[model samples]
Target: MTADDQRTAADLLDAVGPAFGKLRRTALLEVDNPISAKDLSRTLVLNLVLEHSSHSEVTVGMIAELLGSDPSVASRMVSDTIKAGYLTRAASQQDGRRTILQLSDSGRDLMTRFRKHQRDAYDYITADWSEHDRLELARLLVRYVDSVAALKERSRTKEGDQ
Candidate 1:
């Protein structure tokens, strides 16, 4: 890329950082319970389990990988959530020696409410947007994120090679 292209790309990516921060703040404000970043992280892990995982069980290692966090940090977050009655740890059905996490009833309830708040926020923000525009935005945003993730993986592989 040319220097001008690089600068423009950096500027655009920098703008997204603050936009994401604002979104995070808005989400925290919408939640009824006071929560720390760790709590939010745990909630996100639970959401991933609920939405993405086919087995409905996740290990701390999986959480760490998903969150791009250290195992210790992920473990702490998991422990906190478990203590708060948001998650339960049990032996994996496939392997009794392996442990997995699942959301508790309270966690499910919290996620349901959180999802509604998120949907409401999106509806409000896009009230004037045509349905086609909304769908296109969602599709493009996911594509952008996936592209960034792929780029990051490539960078990591290059670094490892070096």
Candidate 2:
């Protein structure tokens, strides 16, 4: 890309940071429970377990990698959730030595309610938008997230090769 094009792209991408920060703050304020950063991290881990537990194992190490957090921090978060009855640990069927994480009934319920709150919040925010525009925004946001994930993976691969 040309210099000006690169600069413009950087500027556009930079704006997304604050926009997401605002969205996160608003969502946290709307949630029934006061969630700390660690709690949010654990909740995301629960989300992953809910989504993928049937197909694969979810472990603390995997959560740490996904959250870009230290493994110890992830472990502590997992432990806290376990103590809260939001998650459970079981020996992995495929690997006896490895422990897998699963969401408890309460965790599932929490996630369900959280999802509704998020949808309601977004719907209210986009009340003036046409259905098509809302759909397009969702599509584009998913594309953006997938692209960024791919970029991160590629960067990690490059670092590993070095």
Q: What lDDT does each candidate get?
A: 0.77, 0.79
Candidate 1 per-residue C-alpha lDDT over 20-107 given as tens digits, one digit per residue, 9 for 90 to 100: 7798766555544445566566677787567545755689898888788999998888888889898888899888999988889999
Best lDDT among the predictions, by candidate number: 2
Which residue window of length 10 is worst by lDDT in model 1?
A: 27-36
Off by over 4 Å in 2: 1-11, 31-41, 152-162
- lDDT of candidate 2 at residue 24, scale 0 to 100: 71
Taking the candidates one at a time, how many backbone clashes does each contain? 0, 0
Per-residue lDDT over 1-162 for candidate 2, one digit per residue giving the tens place of the 0 to 100 score: 555465677787888789888877666655444455655656777877786688789999988887789999988888888988889899999999999998889888878866776677667777798899898988998899899878987999999999
> Candidate 2 lDDT (Cα, whole model)?
0.79
TM-score of 2: 0.75
C-alpha root-mean-square deviation, candidate 1: 6.0
